[model samples]
Target: MTSQSESTEPSSALHDEQAPVKRVRVAAWAADPLTLNGLTQALMGRLDVFVAAGELPADVDVLVVAADRVTSEVMVSMRRAAAQCSAPMVLVTNELDRTRLLGAVECRVVAVLHRSAATEERLISTIDVVAGGGGLLPPNLLGDLLRQVQNLQEEVLTPRGLNTSGLTSREVDVIRLLAEGCDTEEIATRMCYSERTVKNVIYAMTSRFNLRNRPQLVAYAMRTGII
Candidate 1:
């Protein structure tokens, strides 16, 4: 039989391995006290979330705003709040339109949920996703977002000799292949470039955009509908 100490050692290791990650800090605000209080109450007791107080905490991982509608004044406030921190935001609103969505995008709002549809589980999941640097959008909103991106590309970026997504043609090609699971050597061979050249391309793109790695670059590309 195993010694008591030996058995305890494995159990201790397992406990450490299973330890939960740090909870995400959330700051929620709204035009009305009831809305704000309701949001905080809904998120209470969640294992991986901590609601914060005051004007958008500096260390907040996600900022949630409850609003009835997103107007020009709302967009202004969002931009000001966003300027104070780099955290992604989730907008819980009853109204969303193409223009308002675009405005929110400009303010770094990564997720939106209709107040009627914002269940506790869905809200928490969206917060988790945004905190992890992923974006969340309703399926119907996603199509509109893509169309807006395309129109902007056609009307403004194309005339300026820029790709719609701020990526060069070559960078887009490299990232598209990377997204498809091609190794550097395979990509170089296919593109008739040196392996060093392919690596340099990836490094340049990631460095310019502050992406942590190739996978993140691919995710960014996909989120922005570049590939």
Candidate 2:
């Protein structure tokens, strides 16, 4: 079943109710000019929102996209928006394809609003959340996202003997220290372990990942974002 727009929005009760202290820069876009104009106009009416004109500005804080449904073009627009300014986006649409929803998310869409529920109030509220580094999704797509995450954990991470970080906790400690220019003895001392344990951790990671030496290991960690 589908979720109501208001029902699926994240609860705002936890947010401070005080007046907004700063203006948020927003850019609205749509495949249709009328829809884009409407969204831009609605946001322009708010005292705390500065709707951007023409191309999205470099300092835009949020991007609002109105579409009839999620499409490849919409995903491209989302990517362009991310590349242009790195603003979190809100997708107001009639339908979002579950298969491509994660792709949109990777492009930085932080909220989803059903077109039917894209009221001025709802749009403003979602912009507030997105601007504050929060995210929301419809219940149906939320389930899909969770399922994909679970599948990744079960199918890929488990077989590799790793967790979400792609490195075990001890491995992280060892690699982190190595990246910081610590010798094995220093790492052992800092972690309160014997020097042999530190060597073992380094040996295990190198042997497992086919890295040749400590410098290579550190490089691997840095390249893969493990450190």
Candidate 3:
């Protein structure tokens, strides 16, 4: 009996060590108190998430902004909040256009969900993904985003010989895969390159463009029509 108890204790400890960490610290902001309160209630309890109050905390994993519309004023507020911390933002808004979407990208918003479609499950899942360093957008918004990038490239960058989206053809390929959710090893395997090469490509892009991280790189590619 003593030997069995000792063996079980080690196994239990290993299980504890292997358990996934689910706690995510979140901060929410909105022009309307009702919207903010609704989002707060939706995110309460599940996935071990904790929603905090006041200005965005530096340690927060995600920032959720509930807006009836994506106006210039809203964008300014978002930019201010983003300046305080580097947390990814999930914007729930009623409308998005090329201009506003570009503004949101500039503010480092990785996810956008329409007010009508912002179900509790979807909101929670989006927070989880953005917290884990991923980007999310509705399919229609994604199409519009790509179109906006193309228009900018053709009209602005191409005439100035700055077309290559500030990246070489090979670099574009790597970033495209990254936007498609490929990790370093997966990208290397798909592109027939070494893991170090993949890392170098990403490093060069971020360093050259002064981007914050991979998600920012992907957003840059989208804004430039490189992906």
Report the number of the highest-lDDT candidate: 1
The runs of at least 3 residues in candidate 2 whose Cα sits more than 4 Å from the true structure, single-residue gaps closed, are: 1-20, 47-55, 165-171, 175-185, 188-227
TM-score of each: 0.65, 0.65, 0.63
Which residue pairs in candidate 1 collide? none
Task: Give the total clashing residue pairs for model 3.
Answer: 0
**Top of the candidates by TM-score:** 2
Q: Who is ahead in TM-score, 2 or 3?
A: 2
Overall lDDT per candidate, in order of appearance: 0.83, 0.83, 0.83
lDDT of 3 by residue, 30-146 (tens): 878788788888887674444444466668888889889888888888999888878888999987766787778778898999899899988888988998899899888888888
TM-score of 2: 0.65
| RMSD after CA superposition, every candidate | 7.0, 14.1, 9.4
- Judge candidate 3 against the unseen true structure and give its global Cα lDDT, from 0 to 1: 0.83
lDDT of 2 by residue, 20-116 (tens): 5778888777878788778878888773344444567777788888889888887887777777777888889998888887788787887999988
Per-residue accuracy of model 1 over 32-67 as CA lDDT, tens digit each:
778888998887667334443445567878888888
Model 2 residue-pair collision total:
0
